[model samples]
Target chain A: MNAPTSIKEFFESGYRQFLPHVSIDCAIFGFHDNQLKVLLLKMKNVEGWCLPGGFIQWAEPANEAAQRILQERTGISQVFLQQYYTFGEPERNKEPNLKDLIDSLNIEPAEDNWLFRRTISIGYYALVEFSKVTPTVDLLSDECCWWDMHELPKLLFDHDLMIGQALQTLRMQLNFHPVGYNLLPEKFTMPELQKLYETILDRPLDRRNFQKKMLSLRILERMDERKSVGPHKSPYYYRFDKNKYDQALQAGILLGF
Target chain B: MNAPTSIKEFFESGYRQFLPHVSIDCAIFGFHDNQLKVLLLKMKNVEGWCLPGGFIQWAEPANEAAQRILQERTGISQVFLQQYYTFGEPERNKEPNLKDLIDSLNIEPAEDNWLFRRTISIGYYALVEFSKVTPTVDLLSDECCWWDMHELPKLLFDHDLMIGQALQTLRMQLNFHPVGYNLLPEKFTMPELQKLYETILDRPLDRRNFQKKMLSLRILERMDERKSVGPHKSPYYYRFDKNKYDQALQAGILLGF
Candidate 1:
């Protein structure tokens, strides 16, 4: 099926090309300046912000649909994306007066249009390099950008709940999965690595204990100290040992932090 | 919408009362005789077994629908069920010459029947007490029973993949979640508990190390020794400390296996 060319076509016949009641939403997370942020979008006629989401096409797998939607909005491909949950409360997409809202936008859909029907969304969460992302708006959205995890706006629909659950899943995954591959630079200091963990976990960690635990995981390789500063001021830089990191990820190592 | 009365009505007008492209499948795991088992169903005229699954009603929440389906098949309610993944490949549900197969059933559905359309199924895995369950068949299935995890039959559709992913998720959850609250009897020995863990992990663990780790978690409490066995052969009984287990679940403790 071909893509709809206009809003009228999208509302009238989108069900022909896309699965009617199933959609996909992505919680794209990035680490910048020691702050964890999530990407959000403002729809063309909607009131508040929400995650970058789109409908699944008729012949597409759900995972491929999620990847396509992420690439369309962020201009990034091959991201670290994982499906975390499916939100299917009956009234999750219900607005207070949806018909009146659609009328105000000058679109007249049939009483039984697919757009007004209940939808079940598959939720995916992604980790990407912050500096490399170029957030772009889709046809239905007017603006797209990042929002601090701690200072998020009142999101539309059940998006706030989606973000919360996604964050919780990501935090739980840190215990087994080797993170920072997509969120950090090629070379980073030990303190920088600890800060990333501390930020996502939303807690403080002892310096010595954190270093000992991380080093014992055997996923990091320490580089030689920079000679630019004095001996006492110079701190060692470290990068992830990619081979060991992948092996640990496959074997499911436990990081007891 | 009211439930359909017969197979004819279900094929003709079930879409009026149910969501068209969304369904739920459950991988119900039970422990019996030191073996991990999953519940499977054989459809009335189908060739192979599949997970116990059903459609979602128009107004029902997905989670409530899963609980209802589980109760219908197992005669057990309030089982520990969790949503793990959503399967939505375009051909995941496709069967070769399905039209001819439907004709053999002596029921004629329209060319655009909802049942023939692409469906996205929400995958939920449940943990239930094995002894209390009474497996029962549904309208579409001929039999329902427990199949040993290692000896499963060639399943229908993508169900084999679903079971594999669900088991992986369950194994990963063991690192943080306190299991055995529903799988074990009230009083059990250390060997019994260790056996449960070993069965799920698919590997034998060092008995001393397993005991030490479980004890350190502080979610188990020792009980008085049973008087039936000889004094030297007697092993003290133990049960989950409910309060501690719940607390650890909330705090997300790391069990480094």
Candidate 2:
């Protein structure tokens, strides 16, 4: 009820007392076995899944909120998270008002309140290798699972739209850069890389042509041949030369292929 | 203030008040000469010295909100506006709280409850042509002008950050796509296009290579030679072929030398 008299005062004014204001959610995706998987958190109150999201703190950089949240949930802190879009549709939530939020967050469920009752959330998408991740069942959510993208269940709120935008960005990235390395484990075979891309683009690429085009980028470092993994003689496994990868990336090797 | 018991009543409960939000100000840029210029506005208070910005309507799409704001400021419609970053550092505004807004908006000074009091703005940048645009000042803002990128004034709020991000996006776009046609006036010489990119990226490009790359894109239709505009016979002014440009774009032409 007091006036914010200065710059610091203005930023901190009634800030602790808002509906946690704005929040950032990461649509973390990774590729494995030719299947794209997204990390989903199953909440306790509702029989629905949601993105690993957390409130944007005043002290932290607005953009870095998602990365902090990612580290908090999965213990993966070194990866880069690019924010491609913001979702601010007024009717995004399912609750009649802020009642559901009050019950979930343990705040009083009052319709007349302005602070915690309404908020505009921003979405950030990040790509990571699922094989390296260790999912956590945080006390906040009932379960955390890496569900195959093709088999996603009903998501909570506007999360479905966020996922869709992330997919679109993923496809765009593939068409512009060689991104499978970041989405797959190191020393991945040609088939593994191609499958990851196929799942991303949702199209079948000619094996011969895909291999030729990918090799033409001249960034792949041929690892010492390949070892037996399955039925057929395993194809040559390769890891992109880090320095060469950065160079081609600078030259516009969009991750989409 | 009212309480709602049902979904329909929730919307009609008079509790669905519009949140006081900031208008995303976009300075759609166009390249001409060796000078980089962006389409801007002249506001009522400052007059002819602002960027096109509008509030996020309660029932509007976020993208549509930006498009509407652009149309309202410039007579041109359907310009590409992409969100580059948000400017939410509390110290961004120099205005003395709501008083400055009240003075410019012609509202009663005592109307402290006005929605403009709490606005956290997001900035988006667009690519546009200066010549084709007829700057139409928004009713809220007065006067419109095209200011040189290097000569930008002490802009209000975190507009400086917005301008910086726009320049970054411009550089990235130039490297990713052949962008002269949309940003330049019709019947422009190759040199003009080159200069535009140089100014935007703030770096020098090899003239011969730049021309060869642009010519190969086949987006520009060589008109009946270049018309002499000023000193030096303008090296054949060329207009962009919309269909060809779009076709090349759709087919994904390479943007490299």
Candidate 3:
């Protein structure tokens, strides 16, 4: 027999009883086609929708586990995954289907009952461009998609709360940090950037005033060419200058809220 | 022999096994007398100081647990306690004495081992007026005091990190929301407000420019009386108007970073 010496064994010795009880749910946000979207997955065995989530192993840091989940579900690495909120409502996951799955796992009946009774979840939000990735479903889910936020279908458990929290956190984050660069693609137009903010805040923003206000922040670097979208004066494309963006961040200029 | 139902009952079921293992720590922030102060507690068994923390019963929301902790440990209730960070470094609580306390409670030996090895903590920050609060020790602490931000004694676990994150968050929050009103008394002089910002930001702001900038926001209802705090020229006192404050929040005034 091998000695339980590594981090996996080291944590298992202490936290084995709580194995697979806590999980990380991610509201993976993406901006594409001038609309804001979130990555979602359908339940593997049931007709329910959920934010991308995975069980936290005993040895993993919550954040590292979230990042690992991102990699396992989508072939992307080092994206901006922020821990936004933690869901701790009692009896959050006591559904009959979920309980049936626990029984199938052959976990101690009493212990599983206890663990399943009050599952607290740590919520995270990630930003990535929709066109730059492929979805890879883990063993837990059947399919994945970048569902438009306004057109979202019904979600399971407290996922609706998670999404609402993510939106709130995004607006709050924007109050201090410019995100379109990290959240959007490299050569996005001004309208595309503005739409992302408007969608998140769930309100209409005056185009002229919004552009003037954002431009004055001096975080964006205007590119030499315009996006060839349509007949209506295609706006100049812009990319966030790291130098300018960092300076603005230092000045607390993220608010387009 | 009683059924553990609802949230209150849910907490009663596993409170014994969960109480001593999971702790919620708070970064209690108070700005008063023109200096930024944080609440720190003297460790029960050790000479070192630490942030105010207490164990979470299984049934409590992390926020509810934080509120209970803030109230029990500091006798303050319904203050502005907000979750800011979570520290989950595997070796976070590696104290042997702590491990013994956990084991003595009749939890799994592995639970104590896991707690010492995998003790994860959620950090919440509360906003308050320091002059109003008097710290009192609970079962886990011996003494408590409001420690100045500039001069701090050695602390336990990842408390310093929690403080740094709180301060960083506070500074950022100030850029979006006016904070001195809640942190100070109902009516305060402009200079007092200025000094509070300066002390926390650690930057000297121009008096003439700062006054003009603050008055423009229209959040303050300038009062007729002047406070004679110093032997120098007394400044006019201003009280925050709630209507103007809410209006300003809705308008999203550009508070220059």
* Candidate 3 runs further than 4 Å off: A1-21, A95-115, A182-188, A202-219, A226-237, A240-257, B1-21, B45-47, B95-117, B212-219, B228-234, B242-254
lDDT by residue for model 1 (B1-257), tens: 66787777888988988899999999999999989999999876668889999899999999999999999899999767999999989899886335544766799888778888888999999888899999998767778999999999979889999999999989888877778888888888888889999999999989999899889889999987653467577778998999998898778677777
True-vs-predicted CA distance for residue B173, candidate 3, Å? 1.3
For model 2, residues B29-122, the per-residue Cα lDDT tens digits are 8665657787766444552255677666566666777887787666677776777666655445444343443465544533334232335566
Query: Which residue window of length 10 is worst by lDDT in model 1 chain A?
Result: A95-104
Best by lDDT: 1
Calculate each model's fnat, 2 decimals.
Answer: 0.98, 0.23, 0.26
TM-score of each: 0.95, 0.71, 0.82
Fnat for model 2 comes to 0.23
Query: Scoring each candidate complex against the real one, what DockQ results?
Result: 0.88, 0.23, 0.31
Ranking by TM-score: 1, 3, 2
- Two-chain complex of model 3, DockQ on C-alpha atoms against the true structure: 0.31
Which of the two, 1 or 2, has more DockQ?
A: 1
Chain A (alone) TM-scores for all candidate structures: 0.93, 0.81, 0.79
Residue B162 C-alpha lDDT in model 1: 98
